[model samples]
Target: MALSRYDGCGETKLDCVSPGGVCFDPRFVGGDGVTFYFHGRKDQDFCLVSDTNLHINAHFIGKRNPNLKRDFTWVQSLGIMFDNHKILVGAQKTSKWNDNVDHVVMSFDNTTISLPPNEGSKWNSLVMPSVTVTRTSNTNGVMVEVANNFKVIATVVPITAEDSRVHNYNITDEDCFAHLEIGFKFYNLTDIVDGVLGQTYRRDYVSKTKVNVPMPVMGGQQRFSTSSIFATDCSASRFGLNTNRRDGVAEYPILHCSSGMKGSGVVCKK
Candidate 1:
């Protein structure tokens, strides 16, 4: 079969010098939006485009002279079949870890549910001794296993309980600055999120606060200004609130991160 007219670049042409990454932002099911990203290098150009057939392809530009290496080379192409149900389901669960892993979590309500292990470990050996399993207080959960070489990898504890070294400092509040040290271990699960899961992090900082600012109610001219309020003070800072808080029913201490790593131990003083 011959190639369709919509297979290649139509009227509008794009160029890339050296592209680092490319992504398509398909907002909805029927959304026809497409974006092309370009990252340029010295003489070579890397370009990526989502064509009308929902095929995303990457191309690289070579030398300018009339040689075989001068022509654009097709690197890779990703065909996104939105209309196919099986393909859509598989695409939706590209990086899901819970599909085949088995993890057991014991709850206070006498519920034992198997969850998916985070790091994709196959047939994990979770050894809980009779003495330790019976006492189940705030004790450290231990897991011991014998290696093939018979070397004991014993005494494993949580990384947060170990000693941490601080690197830099950050500002916490208007009059307070925080010294950040690496203490806790936080997993960076910064992956591509969708819909509800994506908006959860963005709306976390939304809280109830009373703003006592004056403004025109019906577009009428109204001069309102606080003597203490300055033009520079009106500027908003796009950082995090570095502090500490209690977590869950257990009231575990959770460090507030604003502008540093999640595991960074930020200490604020008056």
Candidate 2:
């Protein structure tokens, strides 16, 4: 079979360097999308993509052994924040890989949604606003689209012999150390837009920052923790007087009588 072409870089392994001590050396496959490679120690957070409105954060998982000469990393969770809303999709760890199941869970706005490890499963939410997630073609990754304009793609592949030999990673368990490839594509993005990696179309964007690190896996069907991405403003609520009240007397007593927490006894008259 003929070798595939990736981003016109041929079949070579493109080194992807980012902050937070992570590196991705991925083979280029022909596509208009930009791919990110992450290889590093476990329990570390890498800011994959960050812009004015969107932020993509990845969390890696694996055993942290200082005595071992070789370490492996796997993608445990992907956190995406669009505007003020955020969503997190993670893979559940299992004692062993199951051919018949795909254990995945998603959390948004303090709500958890789970889907059986089956192909073609999808999740849509209006409450979260303007994002849809679908399982990957191979049921190992996820494709996320926001407002039908921006796309985020994530996939996992086993480290090739070339990669292991080139990086000198001791292969203990083939499944333990997998390569995570993330790609980003925006529709009609203007040249002036700046992000964490700078303008998405710039030719020298990926090579601007470089970091070399030697690394980092997930199992079980447990749900990962969720966090709010929006900043909160502490503001006091002002209750307005109802014009339909009979006698024109303010019914402020009803507000205090409501169950749960107690409110101030003072009431403003209209």
Best by lDDT: 2
What tens digits encode model 2's per-residue C-alpha lDDT throughout 42-95?
Answer: 665544444444455556665544666424566666676665577776666554
lDDT per residue for candidate 1 within 180-258, as digits (tens), equals 1001011111111111111111213221112122110111001111111111111121112232322221111232212
Instruction: Report the CA-based lDDT of candidate 2 relative to the real structure.
Output: 0.41
Q: Which ten-residue region of model 1 has the weakest summed lDDT?
A: 25-34
With a 3 Å backbone cut-off (N, CA, C), the pairs that clash in candidate 1 are 17-40, 17-45, 18-39, 18-40, 18-41, 19-39, 240-258
Taking every candidate in turn, the Cα RMSD to the unseen true structure, in Å, is: 27.1, 20.1
Evaluated at residue 177, the lDDT of candidate 2 is 48
Maximum-TM-score candidate: 2
**Any runs in candidate 1 off by more than 4 Å, and if so which?**
1-186, 195-198, 202-270
**lDDT at 216 for candidate 1?**
7
Taking all chains together, each candidate's TM-score versus the true structure is 0.13, 0.51
